[model samples]
Target: MKKKFKNLTFKDALFNIANYTVFFLFTLACIFPFYYIFINTISNNDAVQKGMINFIPVGINIRNYLALTSVNDLGVSFVVTVARTVLGTGLMVLASAFIGYLVTKEEMRNRKFWYRFLIITMYFNAGIMPVFLNLSMLGLTDNFMGYIIPSIIAPYNIILVKTYIESIPRELEESALIDGAGYFMVFRKIIWPLSKPILATIAIFGAVNHWNSFIDSLVYMQNAPKLYTLQHRLYVYLNEASNLKDIISSSPNAAAMALNSKVLKYTVTMVTLIPIFIVYPFMQRYFEKGIMLGAVKG
Candidate 1:
């Protein structure tokens, strides 16, 4: 049997065309700036400075990256960045999942009160001075824990995890409980597996936050130069040349290899963004579904 379909109206066709055209334009607007930066990064420094490189390359040169990498501290910064991203994201995801699961339990005392308390903190922030003073007193300042410990629990993430858990069939946990499995066992075997989507979402959020944040390192690790993050290093690169001599000293042929400090900024920016670009694509599918599912109220 042949299926019959109604022909599209002229108005509807025009509307669809307009919508797609707008979407394409919007995508181009967002992407072209990054593309322009990439073109500039690889283009000749003279061409870039002369404004000759725009959406197209003038010449290819990887010298910016080479010069940037010649700095020994860049390697240290990269290691620090990776460490914080992994530990911070992992802790946030685990903490949110566990706290979220606990709050949803009927047997847990003060569930509503605890939930309300957490939700209230989402809108309420302790002032920066107070937070800094508290962190100083606790010795979290100038410590690696400054990044991981403070960000382990975000109330919004907890809510998303809890909402996602609410959608899961309770009958699964009930059956496990009937089989003499404890709550932790049930969570380990069942809830954790089922909650992968939201976990990935929260992980992405936490990872990006830790990767991009520089203020914590600046304020907390003021006395500790070795603990500066990649982001803080980049900020220093942009604002001053005090560190350039240290970097230049690393290269044996430093006199011949001209380091274009101007273009190095773009190269460093691209480098900073690379991990996010790589990781986001893998999580994108789960990310979309997770946010939607987490938004739904059971």
Candidate 2:
């Protein structure tokens, strides 16, 4: 079989090479920006200033990272961001999964209407002012609840999950009922276990969203510097780092500090991304299976 497969004609070999070339170029296009950022992060300030840094680091330096960690409020913001990602993603996945399952039930009254209502929400949203006003009414402004609550129910995730769940074989549910299993039991034992891939996908999506969220934090967290998330902290750092020349003219040590802040921005970006990257590989196997199972034809 190997010999036969390897015995391709010149035309076939050309086609295969062309296919791989396109994919390789596409992959490089996607990856080059990240590579540039990484290189820039480690390159020397003088070299960076001279526009010498390209795909490679000109003079390696760790100053940017050191400066970032030395900032007073960054540590607190890191912890806050991690906590929000965990709690917010957990709540979102659970709520979405339950809602998905509920909506998939054919016998449920007004199911179509509920699904349509949920889908409509994805297209239309109350503006930031209304959201802020509502949060203030609920006394959630400047609170962690403000960050986590508003994002708990995602309409798009709900629709994806619902479509997946509806694809589950009805016979499986009938079998569970015949075996004297209640709806909850069937869901817990079978549906939940089978839905791990989609759950992981949703969890990762939610976590990434929560971790990167800055607009909500900025709008709702008035006078609450301690409540700033990692993204917000990074944003502030970048802004401060850009203005470092003026800051350094007043204080000689500020240039070194700014350099450190630049390095730290890269380090923090890597740090924030590492957890999700570690998680995704393990979940990927289940994700493919779950998606296929959830989308199985009747």
- TM agreement with the true structure for every prediction: 0.93, 0.83
Residue-level lDDT of model 2, residues 1-298, one tens digit each, is: 8886589988998998999999999999997877777787677866665667777897677655554444557679889998999899999998999898888888889988998899898889898999889999999998988888889999877766777776667898889999999888888888777777788777777877988888988889977889998888777766776453343334533454434444445555765555666776876776776666545543
RMSD list, candidates in order = 2.4, 3.6
lDDT measured at residue 247 in model 1 versus the true structure, 0 to 100: 72
lDDT of 1 by residue, 1-298 (tens): 1232246677877888899999999999999888888888888888887789877798797777666667777778888989999998998999999999999998899899999999999888888889999999999988888888899989999999999999999999999999999999988999999999999999889989999989998888898777889999888877765467457646774556545666767777788887888999999989999999999994
Question: Cα lDDT of model 2 overall?
Answer: 0.76
- Model 1, residue 189: distance off in Å is 0.2
Number of clashing pairs per prediction, in order: 0, 10
**Candidate 1 residue spans exceeding 4 A from truth:** 1-6, 241-246, 253-255
